[model samples]
Target chain A: MNRYVKLVNFELGRFMKVYIALIGITIISQLAAVIVVSKSYLNNANQAMNVDHMAIETFIEQYGRMSFNDVTNSIFFIGPIALCIVTLLIYSLFIWYRDWFGKNTFIYRLLMLPTARLNVYLAKASAIFLFVLGLVGLQILLLPLERMILQWMVPIDLRWDLSINEMIRNFDRLGIMLPYSIAEFAIHYGIGFMAVIVLFTIIMFERCYRLKGILLGIGYGALALIVFFLPVFVQEFMLYNYFYPEELFMLMLVTGLLVTAGSIWMSNHLLTRKIRV
Target chain B: MIEVKDITKKFGRKQVLRGVTFTAAKGEITCLIGINGVGKTTILNAIMALTPINSGQILIDGAKINKKSYEKITFIPDAITMLPQMTIGQSMQFMQDFYESWNQERATELLGFFKLKPEEKISSLSKGNTAKVNLLLGLALDVDYLLMDEPFSGIDIFSREQIAEVFTSHLVEDRGVIITTHEINDIEHLIDQVILLDDGIVVKAFNSEEIRENEGKSVVDVMREVYQQ
Candidate 1:
């Protein structure tokens, strides 16, 4: 743990500038999304309230008749996500190429790091998670700011609600253990998300034949198909949601174990020890 | 201690290493010299366990280096392209972070000696400085064996001298370094053993002093005769 932490901190320190730049871009793009959503909502409100019936109907009729080609605008919505990926890629490439070890290629150099190859894989995976977490946190913090900006830009009563919070209140009447459910979902998605990243990281470092990598990927897909049937399998094996918590826990445990095993094999065998032939 | 017996490597139909055999004791600088395409680097790769041999085995200190023995040795290959966009500082952080044997103080001191500021991105550093940083990494590692492939081939005279000084200075007891290079002048005085490869085979593997005494020639001259060029 100490060793891996040191490695990640080192990696992050090295590319601090690139990371900061990426965060800046993401914030700007997200803010742009908020502005566009706010304007559209205001336009909808004006028509629904019938404040300017003739003018609003004329505007709506014109827009409704026109074929709204939104390919360009759709591309605009992709800016934040696209920036995240491209920035991470550029930063990863930079670190791989400019590393200290004297080697011919980035993949080979990474393989030759003295740690368990899994640590290298995990460090990058952790970085991706942290990046996403920070973005989500910022969005939550800035959503109120988004509401304020909307009020200034349009006449509608500006209001905001925490999406997850509101949903929790709505579900309180059912006594459905919403908190527990959210926790389970978080655990499930987080493991699954890291697993997906680990799979990619492993695929990138795999020195085996292309066919072998494909086979490994195919094998992973096959296992995923089995996991997808977990709830169904559980349903048929016993009864509906019988031992629900235990079943969920066991499902998570199994997925977590597979991901861990995959990470280790990729790290120890393929990542570090695989030849760059 | 490092040992290779009857090891061979083939890239498709072309054999890169053919039935090679050699050994190096602790605290020795063994120079691997050969003509281009004679597979000097291939042997180094095999010894480092970076490239697996098609036929034989390599025992580092009597233990076969496999997937588990990465800590026993650190490899310094020629022309690193691992992370190009990071500055010296970031690379240092990575090296310091991952390897248990990493010597951060030595790395920092060497950075100063090489006159490389941490702020300078490795992509912007000159080829000579890049080589200097490479040598520094090998020197800083507190491992038993350090295998460097052509440590000074593309570097300049001053940088070569600096690298040689760093290599010799770091050869404490119980440490071994094997280097492959055409520039014999850079290491002739410091090299403990000379292993010459001809067509992926060890044509000559002996002490540096013996080659000087028997052939009455410099290491470069011996290589010229051995390669028949």
Candidate 2:
């Protein structure tokens, strides 16, 4: 058991309660959205055929068959997912601040651990990444279950059934989360991980110098963002589209790695030499 | 030996430590005596590397403090460092999880010595009990050097006495201990050396036995003469 792994487990355990609640909320809210959307679609179908004296074919033609897309678009479904994203984003900051501002000063113990101080920084970033991935996995698992409930409620003739793949592709946000290809998934999440690392570095700056550190942190973050996007800036403006798409992508990848490495190096320096608890 | 040589620190415009220097041996108890806000705790923090000093060198056995220094030395701050939501047992477990120097046997003995239940949450402990637990955490570490900051600052008399008893016990014997406190009446005879700090510098530092034998002065009498001057 590496100390970093142990630290990650410890960090995860601290947030286990809130993590479980987020999972529970996502499951319950998404499931309820499916049911509510299905029942309402069915009620509209029955009213069109019986109350309006229209044929079943005519009713289907008018309302359009209900699919998982309707449920995905509802607030019940999107709200929970948004909440999870917002909570995790906030947790990324809260995780560090909590140790400092909690009931007791646990930062002292953390800084005093008999390992590289960067392990503490990296472990915290790992925990936040794990939480985000866990929620993404949960959403993937819940899609089929949600589809089953929708199938059970809506009549076969009046419903538009979609496979799990079709359902995800049709919804915009879900597609972003569960990308169509493995390469896109890797790219999306690699950038996400880089952002987290950069944010952790900013937090390190703030912890090191307090009020002055806050300004220093924000300035560092902005510099990192500009550095990461420099390739695109050069591609669009200075090069005048001189580079091919693949070349531009490669250039961006290089810059992203540079920024990520720079942030980690800076965070390590601050943690080991400049940090105060 | 722990040698803190000519360390200086500044908190913005306010200079807290000015060329402060001292040394504590492996088997001596060095007490840092200062009034409120006189950089006593700051010096202890500097020794532990909890806070960075602007200019100085602190060496434990002629080596700089690093990650491994934590295993050889530990600091018990004035306040508890564990989360309040953690139970006494969980806090001990956390210590075990991190520090290879954590001594569970000594920890358990300290628990009994302090009459603390493992199941008790830290948030629910009284001020005296909390101080005991804080001391227990540091004392249970099998390290050569221990830096304690204001161990008896705001505790009941009995708790203070119980904590004072730890100095004479085997838990601290043969180990270097640097403790900061303004009140010295309780452990006047226990400490081997005294470093008197005033306005961020060492005004006087001497062995208690030597001062008493040569000048017929208790630690208090020397303090009165220096402070009143």
Candidate 3:
């Protein structure tokens, strides 16, 4: 196997325990959300028909039927996803800092590895990407199971059925994570990957220069963002919306690639030449 | 041969190494003697390329250090570099996974020599044992050059003796070894060359045997004369 792949596997193994816990939390919370939301809706229906002595048709007219949309809106449903995202974002910085600040100076061993130092940086980025994708895949798999639980809890007449597609499309956050089209998914995640790479470069700067490097890292990150958005700035202000939407998108894509390449090159230089352990 | 030519380093406004120059030949043990905070460890770190030098060059066999230089030269820092949570076996396995130069046979032999258990977690080890494990990891690597920083610092007498025994053993034979230490009594006779560092420069570099034979002075006597002056 390639050393980079081995490094990725090693990085993943280090975080395996926390990653498993995140998956477990997402599963249990999302499933509980479906059951809880469905049961409460049923209780409301029973109260309307029996306690109020209202007809079933009158009760149905007054209260809308329950669907996966209700469960998706709850904290129990979105909270775990938010937790996973936050954990991963924190992990991006932790992955590098841990080697330096852990019980021992493992950064020494990492830098001493008989391979290009960039492999260490790239391997960490790959691990974070894998973790994010893995969680997204888990969410996709859990949706149908959650829907099944909802169907089992709420009676047929009292509930509105929605396919997995409808459930995801109805939830704005879920739609962002699991885009309907492959192109949108690629574009969304490509930008996400670029952000992560830039963040890693910033981390490299900090590691190289310590206190002064912190400001340098932040400055580099801001510069990258400005460069990435330059096309939109030019299109809106200087050209007065002269470029078509597709042309603007193309220009942004070029800028994004440029920034991503620049970050990687800078990180490589820092790792190989300027890094301190 | 490892040639460090007039290397200078600065930490903030403090200059740590000021045009330090020295060379250690293959099959010879070169001891860098300095008091506390005299850039002994810094020189070793420079040779391994762990820290960048501001000016001058370090060449291993006439070429500069690179990724491949790691396979040829390894540094055993004052402390173990493996994660404390890792067991001795897992730490060794990690080294094997990364370095093609890792010698499992020598590693196992060192484990027995140090009376260390593979199942033992690094965090659980005593200070002496941890140092032993650190030395074991570096000694097991089939590298031509080995740079050790303060190997005997803050260790028990027995552990120090056990570690000193490694120098005479085949594990270090034919390898270029550079060790930094303020306390030189234990291995005074073992080292072939001595580089005395003071205020970040090589005050004296000489063959130990020649100094003893010609000057009629022990390394300690020479140290007293040079430092007192």
Candidate 4:
């Protein structure tokens, strides 16, 4: 177990500089989101008279009640776009062309540490998990800023009472205190997002062959289709439309762990057979 | 010490290594030589626990070399295989963090000796320089056994000489070193043992001193005789 930690630390250490840059980008993006949302809230608040408080509150609630489908679509769309752009700029242009990214030899070189391949996989997976968690934490921090942005955008007549601290206090009331611990509502969604990456990291080894890359992408789509409707398929597709937050978190965590396991399992299994570079 | 028994590996019905068996003693250099596609690299990879054998057992110091054995052995392939997106410095740091045997000071000194800039990405290095880095990595490891595949291929004569000197400086007693290469002239003086591999079978295994004393021939000559049968 201790050896595993060292391997993971080393795995993450390889990308420490890049991770630092990633965190900076995340902070900046969250700050922007906060500003944008806060301005929008403020603008809407200015238009409403005192008598229309209830009406405006209703409006905000109705508008903000984004369905799971909405959130999933919004978040997943960001996944590929963000990843591609970042990888292209950071890795393809700077690392690939320059030959600085050692991931091309990740399996043969990096994974061959004086430890188990399972441990190596877990370490890298942990680093990615932490990377995504850091972004979510920053996003949570920017919530009040977003509220401020909303007000700035609309200049509503209603008086502002909630400071960023109060809103965060409400979050604490909701559950959990540490920045690392996400809102209960978000743990599933965030973990699911990460699980997809874990699965890809393992299956992406197929990139050694052009055909395999396409096949893996398609495979990802297929697995997503199955995971999306798994509850429906197991219990009853029509009745199980809604997801329980705790249940969802549990399911997402399990699937993430399984896929994480599968990723290492597949990598180790396939490597035993001598796959492509 | 290492021993392999009843090992067979087939790649899609093509039997590359068929029921091959061999033993390598501690603190001795065991050179495996064979023609291309004859499973020379496969055997080395298998022994190093990089590749899995179809049906066999590999024992290292009486303990099987499995995921458990990985923490002790380091395999250096024939080519300079590293993440092209890293500097020699970053690579050294990574190795140092993971392996107990990694010596950072030796790594830095060797990097300087090779004239490779720490900032230079591996992609920019010439093939010879790449090979130098690969050898540098192997030499910097403070391990019990070092397995190198074709360490001298494609390297310039002068660089090979320098690398040889580096290896000589780093070689410690009771620390096994196994290197495979067809370029016998480059490493002829350094080898202590010869394990002649032909058609994936160990036809001859000799102590270098004994061969030189009794047979009165270099490894190249002895290698020719072992394969002649």
Q: Best DockQ goes to which candidate?
A: 2
lDDT of 1 by residue, B98-196 (tens): 667788888888888888888888788899998877677666777888888787887788988887777656443458878888767767898889888
Which parts of model 1 have CA positions greater than 4 angstroms off? Answer: A13-22, A36-113, A151-180, A201-205, A210-256, A259-263, A275-277, B65-72, B89-119, B165-174, B214-225
Q: List model 4 lDDT by residue over A71-145, tens digit each.
A: 112333234326533543343223212221343345566446666655654565565555555555655565555
lDDT of 3 by residue, A63-158 (tens): 888888999999999999999999999999999999988568789899998899889999999999999999999999999998888888888887
lDDT of each: 0.65, 0.92, 0.93, 0.62
Isolated chain B TM-score per model: 0.92, 0.99, 0.99, 0.91
lDDT tens digits, residue span B92-174, model 3: 99889888999999999999999999999999999999999999999999999999999999999999999999999999999
Give the residue spans of candidate 2 off by over 4 A: none
Worst 10 residues of 3 chain B by lDDT: B42-51
lDDT by residue (tens digit), candidate 2, B1-229: 9999999999999999999999999999999998988999888877877888999899999999989989999999988999998999999999998889999999999999999999999999999999999999999999999999989888999999999999999999999999999999999989999999999999999999999999999999999999999
Best by lDDT: 3
lDDT per residue, candidate 1, A59-155, as tens digits?
5454431111111133443476567666665644344334423444555556566656667667765665565556556644654565455456654
- Summed over model 2, clashes come to 0
TM-score per prediction, in order, is 0.74, 0.98, 0.98, 0.69
Residue B100 lDDT (model 4): 76
